[model samples]
Target: MRKQLTQFMFSILLLGRAVAALTPEAAENVPFYHIPSTIKYADREIERLNKNIQTKPRLEDSIQFKAFGFHSDYLPVLSEIPDQPRWTLDLTFETYTGIEELFLVPTMERRIGRNYNKNAPYGFPSHFRVSQVFPDGRIQPVYEHNGKPHLSRMPLFIAFPEPRSSSVRLEIFKGAVEENREFFALEEIYATSFSYIRRAQSVKVSSAIESPPFWGLNYLFDQQTNLGQPLGPKNPSLSPKQQKDFSANFGHTPPGCAEIEIDFGENRPFGWLILYPALWPEGILIPGYGFPGKISGTIIPENQDGLRGSSSEIENWTGGSPGNNPVRLHGKGHIGRWLKLKLSDFPQHNGDYIFAMGEIRMYGNGRLYPVSGIRLEGFPKTEFADHMFDGYVGGQPVLFFKDWFFKTINGNTARYEKQKWEYTRQALEQRLDTLLRSTAMSIAVTTVISLGISITVIRKNRRKKIIELRRQISSDLHDDVGALLGCSMLAARHLEETLSNETDILKVRRIIDSTTKAIQAMRDIVWVSSDNQDSARQLAEKLEETLEIYSGKYEVSCKHDHLLNLADYRLQFSEKRDLLLFIKEALHNIDKHANATRINLQITVKQNRLKIIITDDGCGFDFRQAPGQTTGQGLISMRERANHMRGIFTIKTSPGNGTEITLELPVKKKPSPLKPRETTNESN
Candidate 1:
């Protein structure tokens, strides 16, 4: 028991260790730039405004497309740029540097209401390569992608080989599409060096879109993303608790613009204003749902007349759909006590416009200020206007950006590890099942072989037993018939001696009797040895023949023919030999000692038992008196032989009564082979 317990504990320990190894570590918090930094991109002209292709302010923004119009000449003709119009993006650094990893987001990060090709970008090259440009202008290939179509929402993470360069270049080949118009769209790019990762900066593109505010190269460097604020390992949006007392429904309204205003009791200098999009309970609204497609706002000073026609302004700003992420507006070196916002293009709900928001956070002097009051104007409902600043999004607390990001990343890592472990466990179980089946088959084969061997051994043993039985029969013939023959020889020698002394008739008679006994013994041996005489009725026939031969010397008669009725019964070798010898001994004693005139024999079977009775009409002796050597020896031999055959022996006689001997034995149907004779006390 102790040994089994130890083994069980060891197995449990191994299982626990395996589980621990598969467990994923917590996600690490990373710092990124919240404002545009040293990043640069190619500048272009659009609507008389200088723009770039690297960045866009709105989630639905894209770069300008180039296609040959059948009648236009301003754009390149389709034939002129059939293999032309390839675009190249380059990032240069002051000194030679190498990056360990790179992340490329090809399309918008938020998956709210926008629709596009999810398997690869619409015009992305089927194949692309990233190369390192050294100071000597030697281009060394770093990584190449086969560009097989796959799900394209998460950033494509790539690791570079040991490479160092002053600049990196990404070139896209045209002709991905058969149409004359071809263009590539990318959301963002990030590069990691050692443990530090930052947005790609100082980019130079060969051709780009020129749009302001929305599709501009500079807007790409802004760290705003659909991931929203970094969340911990737990997603608050999935399981959230409402922190605000919501009594009014702001989702139903007419299709029109609405204005909201907030007042900070005293004039306070501010640098940033962040707007968080509204989310509804039970998926009533998607993330960023009900957010206006276009928004214009301004900051007003406390001394200004805060009315419909007030002209006093601190800073003016414009914003668009921030998606799930909150949009931050930077102040233009101004101090304001009143801020007003006008929103348009509310999403439709039940054929009507709906408007809602999560929260509004204002920062000034590196800290957040508690707003004094909020006012909603030109809306059907305004009772729950304070809900916008309830410090909750979708009924969940908005965690710090870094905390939320790490938690979300770590959750994904843990989930991936669990999936891998599940697959491995299933594979191992299958292997174990196969092994068990194979072992069972081996056991079955071994059992069959063992049974065959056992059967062969049993047959060999049976053959040996038959040989031993024949030998035992031979020994019995030598003991019984040889003794009788020796007696005959003695009688013949006596007769010869008497022949010279007047031809004694008694001696001659003795010779004939001895010879006859020897012949009878020989015949009995032959009958017992014969395999064909195994039935009980055959034993009676052989006994009757012995009586007939003996009748010549003494009268003998069978009282009944009951022995013939036992034809179905059989006797074993030992039983037949003992029964025949017993009867012969009784007759020899009577012939030598009793002056018998008539002898009667009776044999019968009753209830599967055989009974034999022999009687003589002669001078009988006392049943308890001791007899002479020869007579006593013969009598004891008869009794012992009968006992050995598992039969009962009885003698009834008196001085004047005739002697009677009876034997009863159970009949054997299927007799066994001969066995060695057992030594009895009668012989001793």
Candidate 2:
């Protein structure tokens, strides 16, 4: 229990350090330092972390450090066997020693792949951290070197640490939010084992026998051929060089069996065997030689000969057509000094029969063995055998082959972590995508609804203005022009009957003058409502001119004040119509009713509102009595028109006081359709 807590704390410290040092600038230095010789298998793996920290890596996989804080722990990172649980990463440092750093880099060592992991360029030298912990729970120097080598092989299976007097604890830390800091993670420092060096030794092969298609033996068990050295280029034809170096034969002559035999110096235990089929061009097996249709492999005692023990297999092997064929050795395999593989009853080729092979390899005693002696029998002397045994005994075994196996395991392990990460990320992004789609859809719906409302309002307002204009025009023709036309008709009839009455002629002339005046008045109304006269400046000038013409009938003086840039402020057709008509009515009242003389008009606009004030210094009438006693539109038409326009109108007048009228209207409101009044303009 105490050990678990210590390891937990160590994990926390290292993670904290990782978070702080996760800056892009700092990640460049991580994973570049060297590790002790007791750790490296053949080359340096620490330097594999590139200096490009431009994109931080991300790793989200589960890991545990069971053997990290203490010794006497045994667990593998992973077991290649499927039934076993995946190994967790663990590490240990020398107790009471110094602090160290570990860099975690994320890389899929391949090309710009069209596949999943290959395209993920994220998670490079992803994470970094410094560790300083001692076995006694004491602090150590910050940047110490010469720390014990804690990792030798790539971790694949769960493994425990060997016992020690004092064990080291790594500092605990957490990851950082900085993106560049996310490339990779070092879950724990492993307490590397040196015992593998002592327990592992070289295996010596005694001889090779009748592994006919002699060149095929070299293809399979060439000891000089190490990791990364695959079979040389294949050929369908035996070139002079191909015959000299690679070609081999395996068909039996007629009587004797065809097979290959390998001998170890003494009795040994066996675990597995592998055979690599020599490939011709396009991966076809060579034409003259094919795999044995019936073969038996047995482990016999070193002193005894013949198949005298329980054999693992004695049957026809198939599916040896393309690549390698590997079989696990079973039964009491310890008695064998020779692993004998016998082939007979070859299947017919072009005309004859043969069983050909490329290379053979065996694994036992915890190490890959080298073939010491090779013996080929039961064949004509003309067939040639290259020095196949020499290749088997030339190179170092563990460093050459096992290294490849372990590295492959590591790559597979990384792939496992990657698959899990992708699944989680994809699920989260899908939910986010759904939310964004919903928001966009809602916004679009709202915009469409608002547009519908706006169009309706515009059409309705236009209809209202049309109705109002027609009523005003109808009233003008009815009250003024109709009366004149009637009077003229009467005068013409009277003159026609009498022929020469002076009184009748004068009456006809008066009628003609009245008709002309009424027509001009109607024209003036039409002109006021015209679009061309929409500007305030134009309205003001026209108003002054109307006042001048009306006041011409009296000694009254009319003055108009000009508002600056008021013309720039345009008025709608309805606003101009109503404003000009109201002014005209007031002027008409002063002309025929108000007995006094001075009139002043001021027009101004501010903040999109137009204000017009008309003041008359004349004998005024009562405001209250004007509504009932007055004729024509009186106060009703003015008030109704003002309300329809969404403006305010006021009249200040009394028996002895001058009258003042004011109207304020908004420039943007569409004119409301106001109902016409029944009354007409009689007098003020």
Candidate 3:
């Protein structure tokens, strides 16, 4: 029996494949029919009678019939049908052309009464009715008027028995004008048997209902096969095989109808199932099959009407009412079970066909689990205590204070460091100023002290020089005068002794004359020193007198000239003394040392210089050797006097030649005051 059933199912599947192979245009125009064995006799009798009593012959080309049958109990377990003394027959017919004008030849069987094992009338009945099956799997009735069938726009038909019964039989036929035969194509048919059974009030809900992942599915509505093909001529009816083939081609298994099994393990606690029905196909908006239902789990209708025949106990399982309806299943026992979905009714309302599933949740015993491992919709809120505790006991305040203090201290330190640098710079500048001042004061003090010392030393040196000059002058005067006196005495003594002889008397007279002149010249020198006359002029007068006195001894004569105005001459007293000494020395040298016949003394003054020239016609010595050979005191005194007066003295002489002494002393208009000094003793 199982093998036979399997073969039958295989045959049905093969028929669907054959229908799919037809060309789209042919399939669109073709009509299909389903004939059951119970209805076959009625249809065949009509065909046979029409063949025998042919008038304007009914053409086989006008229509064709194909047949298929199922034992009707093959799907008994699935359909929940009961076994009884019952039989059922299903029929379908299709018309290609003249669909409005076509009619089914009803059989003589009346629908009012039932009799077991009794045959009904065999001829076509006068009353004909037409119906259609809609795409949503709805069967809608059509009215019969004046023995003619009125077809509804729907594509499904439903005919109920006069009295409710477990079994039913139906016959169907098709008729169209012969002329429209060429426009007719017959394609397929479909049939189904429904058996009545007492339904149990207690409903069983599955433990788990699994849904497929909701990615990449397109939604559609009223989806028919070969929709693009042109509608061809209609046919009146379809055979059983034709209906099966047509349904196999045009009918579609609804999305989500695939049975899915879910296991939540054993002995799970009761929980609430929150299904997101929004994930279903948009076709859920349809009126019948697509609507939510309570048969599989727990359903809350989105529409108010619920399901069709909602008052009937059997239809109470259909779920749509209206408005904001939601489907929720409670109890955790439903976690593991297999669920089968029905989709045939979805096309009645919404046109879309996409299938989807939103987040599903299960709440049980203070625990929640997601239907597909999805989490709750929103993030969980944190507790206030957690935040408060985190803020405390972390030493965050100390860290913050340290950071702030460090920054503050760093800034202050930087500022103070800058100030310190500036202070150091200021101190250095002050020190530099102090050092410069100290150096300048030291230099000034040292310079002043040095200048004072230098002045004192210079003055003392000048005083010593003045005393030396006075001594030198006195010594020079004494020596010259003493020497002249000695010569005068000797001459006088010789004259007295030689008075009796004539030749000696002349020599003695000459000697006595020289001595008297010498005494007079020395008196003149003394007179000039006391008189305070210009030293140069006085010295010139004395020199002339000395030379005259020396003339008796050596034939000497002195001449003096004063060219400078006496009042205008500015010689210092020391300089006058020096000039007098220089001239005296020259005259003395002529008297004592020059053994010559005559001497000449000349004094000349010009500009700031006084020149004294003494020439002697005497035996002169070599001047270079004279200073070394003789006591050069006179020469040394003359040179010293000249140097004291800032003058120049020169001697010109040679052996056997006359000697000349030149003294050139510069005279200044405003001579410096002579330095006073105590006289030092000098040997004559």
Candidate 4:
């Protein structure tokens, strides 16, 4: 119990520090920095904090510490002409494909060595434009980025609008400038839709430096980034004993030239082949450890030994450290039932030069061929040769290109968010330290006392506010639902007395309508209290559904464009509830007072402000006497709701003229006094 109290006090101290750090000047600079936008980001931070609390193998304390291990034999692509007029990369697809966004990885690593470079290379374009090219050679601009210079080493994500085209074009207005020379350089580019990355069938570049082994055009579509392979933060590094046991369970390779043959039972076309390198035993990842210095592949007929017949060399790779980045080789148009891989010049581990590989994969017809459970053979009955095709590396499944890209990009983004939070935390700490040093001993004591008193008062006030909120919600529920339900019951009782008349049928419809309104009122009240429904799109959807309930009585015309922008923005709970209620009340007023035939509701979003206009062609009331009119309470309620959301509400109406109601609201509301999810003692 005492330990629990001590921990609670420590937490309180941290809370005090945070509260003190958030001064008026400091608060303006941080926009919702305390709130996490995604669950993955929050999980990452929690895991990191847990690891920090518990001591383990201490890796480098840097952003790259959690990055995937990667290496490539070639450099990033660059423009051939340093001062070229315009550098263009055109991607032609085999069929028409829709591209919603483009993801570009800059040339961060100038060269692949023992470790990947963290800095981006020179000559990255400052501004660029992406367009769609038709088969008739007409180009339409789809997206453009003309913001500040692209200097960050991170990947650039550009969103495309209205994308459905046969081909795409990426053009640079001005190439990157360095030392009075201008050139465009990029490590990789990907056109992605909502679900998957769209791989272009062919690529065309206006000018590219196609130097072999260092720089080439292939680097642009290599699917390799400097961010390396996606790896977990707590990936285990086996101890010497563990390694020994693992080797005993999943045998290791013996020294010498090793050849493995895979028979497909029938002739099949293979376009891509991947060779996954062995995992580093010590966790100090040397990418291509124990991988052969020289590798060769050959294709042969089925059911025949590769050694007994003449085989054609399909692919060859020499001298490359393929860390977590698997060696992917293309064998386009190669049709064979049997594949033979010859590996030589093996790297030495301990005292022997041994050849070890995690897995081998072959792909054709845009799908991975099932290699698991397929019997493999070795030329000389190589020890542990079958273990190489187990579809796993260090007990973990080998990741595909798209899966790896997704994980690596998400990991990099999470790291970036972590770095931002860390910077903000450090700034807060520094300000806190300054504040502490500037305060005298008496002032510090008085401040602590005042803080304690303030905390107590705040708690009491918070409880009172919660109770008041519950009371407000309770009163609204009573007025909206209870009154309607009561009217529904009274109408039902009235229906029995006039059972044979047409008036009874009309009375039955009124009762059904009243009951539905009561149910809808209850549903709205429940929706308003829900914590999850916060997005503007959800609010708009709810509003549309509410408006649809009145479709039978009046002709409803609703227009809401810019849904994408609304989808991206979020609204506080109070703002969402109030705005929804305000619109519903306006529609309700039109139904009750005005004999309207046609109703029009148009909602537009501009400059972070949401405008709602509702008009009806009906006998309208006098705007001057609206407050004293029969429908005065509904108007007052709508105005109060709008005012609560910090919005502007106006009604323009005159006798025999149509009524127009306009509401202008900022999408984002100021911080409310009440916190989220706080439970009150009052019950419904």
Candidate 5:
């Protein structure tokens, strides 16, 4: 009894420690955190944690500092840009003890961290100061953004204004405090250990700028490499003038007229355009990156706007504000491939007479169409003329509170973030509501049926009723809902075929393809839930049809049902559901990630043993390698489903060798099964 008591006390102590390790108080004691590997469960765990944070935003306050530091490293994992040494800082706090720690870990940050920046520099925090600390502990060249002498919010990231000054110091004033409070709490400084990171050269696609054909032709200007870089598809506008001396790329259309055209490939809903003379870095415009004179731009409707056309012209913007303010052109809801921008007028400068500009921005789809589909006409070819599109944009790539356009466009950075959180919260609440209703109804039905069926074989009758309910749900989920989804998909396809514009066709096709995939998923769920689909042979048949349907979405060829002998291996509810999900996931993997062209499926059962094999000829990957953004979740899910079914799952593949997956699950009961149905690959 003494020995047993001692063991019990020891076990109790161990359990206490386990609980302590998970507590906020205990986390403060541990200084070091293991860097998270972005693979398998870690990615999923981070996603789950982030969703929780997004849904219950107030939960952020409850989070301990150490926990925040540990989790932030994993939650918002972003890919790192080459050559740019990414730096991240943390303001650690212990919610329970009110303890805090400031950390500056300038380690070679991975792309997949909570503070990860997908678009470096551009996507970094808009407001924050950066300082470099030499080995002597003296900081230099204090910089400030958003008129604040402070560091950014928690998990703050910033580019070294001077990349050579590796040793850095950050002065954080208020860490993630409520916004717009005057120096409320953000202020602190921390030292850093600059670890050396040698990364590969970043691969960004670019090409030499070719002068686009000018519609409503006026003249061609000099070809200079002065136009700023393409600032992504989403960046709305750039500063109109140069603050630096490097701006020199400029052009002027003759006294006659100037016009440019953009082909969006389809009828895209365009809203507005901002035309401003390139300010210093926004474009290669000379001197103050400002306009030399006032000018206006209008969209020509082929025949209107005094163009060689027929429709009325739409005037968008006129230079009527300070700093050569950009004119905002509201196109209403213009849809078509061809969009025209014509310079209406300009004041002559430098002893020449013509309209001129520094940069032009097209705003639609909540982003700027920098240079994806635009053509320029009429250039007075000069040595610097080609610089207009040489991809060298310099200006504030992002909007600050001071920007006039911010209010014009209704920019709400923080509030919208909360709005996003609210959206997620509402979604979760809806899901919870659905789950509660389902559980309550199920329980009520089960209890009433059990109590009323006392005369009927209670246990057997309840099970029969359950089976009937499942059948009804399955039928409803597929026959009714699935039919609607299928019809929508077909309608989208019909629209694609009937549409004259290739752009519209592509858009419709995308919708059709997505809807078709949804239908496949729905059918799989229904197949698993229906009581009649408990047979193992039915599983095989479902797998074959399912693979073909999914593969068709990727435009891949699929061959199935070359079966030898099919046995009715009956499965329980759990087995059937898991198995069906497994097959669905496998097919989904091939369709989305495999890049395969042809899929071959085999369902073979021998001596009451069941085996289902799916082979695909595509750019196969090594299963043992580290998972990337594409294959990580798929591989993890496939393995997890196989484990749930207690089945043997194996994949065989190598780079360029194609992939083959085989699953063998235990048979519950063997029944006399029919011979394999002879079906060709094209039978679907």
Candidate 6:
């Protein structure tokens, strides 16, 4: 039995050691006597307690107690579990090494799930209560509900008080619960202590809080001395009256307490402040008196939603309807930081408290800022033409003035300026072209008419000349040749009748022969003069006969060859005339001057030129030297006639030699339609 008891004691010791080892340091620090949950009693017992209590039964008596025992098997309660707390309390002792005074104020977030549990016996609480304990075994209760206390609820608590702390033991508590529980839960506990001391001091509350349009005021605390006015002294440059005005415009005065100081800091160029009067919430504006000052820091306007008007007159400040109130101004000097207020030129009446100032921001350096103004003028459309006219009129500035003047003054203008220059020039050119053509046509017509008239006149004159030549030839033939023939016939007749003796008869025969020669000469002359084919042929036959009559005086021969008919010769009168003249000259030359014992004469007519050759063994004279000695006029006359008929004449002769004369004269002949018999005559 003794061994069994010892074993049991050993097991108990081992169990205690395990429990001690398992407990955390934070859990050990907590006071063991604190209630973990509500304790409940029987109903009859609560009634008895109520009769034994004071005038009203305190609901605290109905409280029931439940022991919260440690069990490894049970799940840990949330209050028994450790957590990070919101409030921390601290205390410090000056005389001792330990703590002296401590206090804690916790920040509460009314979270539904964390502050209360629906699983608790009670419903949602109308108020919350908590108790704090100190190391000296003292306790205090604090209550709060909906950010206030129960006495603040009047009949419930005597007083709703603020927490207090001094240099002593400290305690901290909270009012909370699990979100699912119907009752509130307490999660954190804190305790501390420190030493305490007493002293006299001055405190200053800040005047930073003010009505709209008033700002830039700060609070100061001074423990040195007690004085009624917190702000020391005003700057000497500002008179009392000016100070009053400044305060009135700003809507708040500096705080009056010793230990508190008001600092306007630095007054920058082009910066101003604005205030709104208490009576006029919308009547807030920058004061005109501070227009040229600089801004120290940022200035925010009050009732900024009331701001209105064009942006032209305002610099550095946003101007619009005052939806987002308070325009902000920033920076240091005149150019970008200044604000100008045109309050003196305000359009509306200034009466009562209708005027208020908000903020004034000034912009420094006028060159960097822009100012705007408005102007009204009528826009003229017709006046633009007047400007052009002024430029172009006399004594005015004009482009290409010389060219314009030359054209305008000389009655010449550009094509576009003239009415119908193109049409008129084209018409004039066409008219000139037409006139030239007409003149050319007239010249051609006149030339043709004049040529026709001249041709007609020439033809008529040629016909007349031909007729006159025919008439002259006819008269010569009749008068000269006819008379000669008659004389010849009379001489032959007279010679035959008057002769009787033999010598005389022979002389008569010689006279008859001479008459016969004269008759032939007359016939030849007539034939040449007549220019007819029958006359030409008759003359040829008669010459042959006459040459035969000379056969006794000399060995004379005559040959005639006719290549053309008599009718063909008549049609060529000019050729007939030329041929006749050539023949006559040949015969006359032989008869008078040949002095030859033998002679031969040949005549041929072919195509045009007539050829005649006369050859004689005669006493030939030097033709070059004897032109004057010999009767050579017949040869000259034959050449002249041959030239007239476009023929050739030639003579060949030498002293103690025969003479040959060749005459070729052109004959214009027409071939006979009927063939004529060829005739060749040879006479000796």
Q: Per-residue lDDT tens digits of candidate 4, residues 1-684?
A: 234335435544644554455444553354343323322343566467445423221212222211221112222345553343266788865344466556676665444575644464445666678888877777888777664666556556655566467578987766665455556677767675533345567888777776555457776765545545432233245433323101211124554555667876567787678777776656665656677778888876543454434466776878455544567676655777778877676666666554567677787776667653333333333445555665556545556444444444444433444444455555555555555566676698889999999999999899678756866776677777677777776867677566877876776877777687777777787667655567677777888888898899889888886666667657876887788888888888889878999899887777879888999999988746655774578878987888898899887888999899999988863344676786678852
Better of 1 and 5 by TM-score: 1
Tell me the deviation in Å of residue 553 in model 5.
7.7
User: lDDT for every model?
Assistant: 0.59, 0.45, 0.39, 0.63, 0.46, 0.37
Residues 499-523, candidate 2, lDDT per residue (tens digit)?
6778776776777666656656665
Worst 10 residues of 3 by lDDT: 214-223
Best by TM-score: 4
**lDDT, candidate 2, at 44:** 27
Q: Write the per-residue lDDT of candidate 5 for residues 580-649, one digit (tens) a residue.
A: 7777777778777778877777776556556778888888886567358336776688788888888889
Candidate 2 residue spans exceeding 4 A from truth:
1-503, 591-593, 605-609, 623-627, 630-632, 666-684
Q: Which stretches in model 6 have alpha-carbon errors above 4 Å?
A: 1-495, 498-522, 534-562, 565-579, 603-610, 619-647, 654-657, 665-684
User: Sorted by TM-score, highest first, which candidate order results?
Assistant: 4, 1, 2, 6, 5, 3
Model 5, 52: alpha-carbon shift in Å?
Answer: 95
Evaluated at residue 670, the lDDT of candidate 4 is: 31
Q: Decide which is better by lDDT, 3 or 6.
A: 3
Q: List, residue by residue over 211-251, the lDDT tens digit for candidate 1.
A: 55434454444434433442222223443444332222345
Each candidate structure's TM-score, on Cα atoms with residue i matched to residue i, is 0.43, 0.36, 0.26, 0.44, 0.29, 0.31
lDDT of candidate model 4 versus the reference = 0.63
Worst window of 10 by summed lDDT in candidate 5: 216-225
Error of 4 at 254 (Å): 13
Worst window of 10 by summed lDDT in candidate 2: 64-73
lDDT of 5 at 486: 78
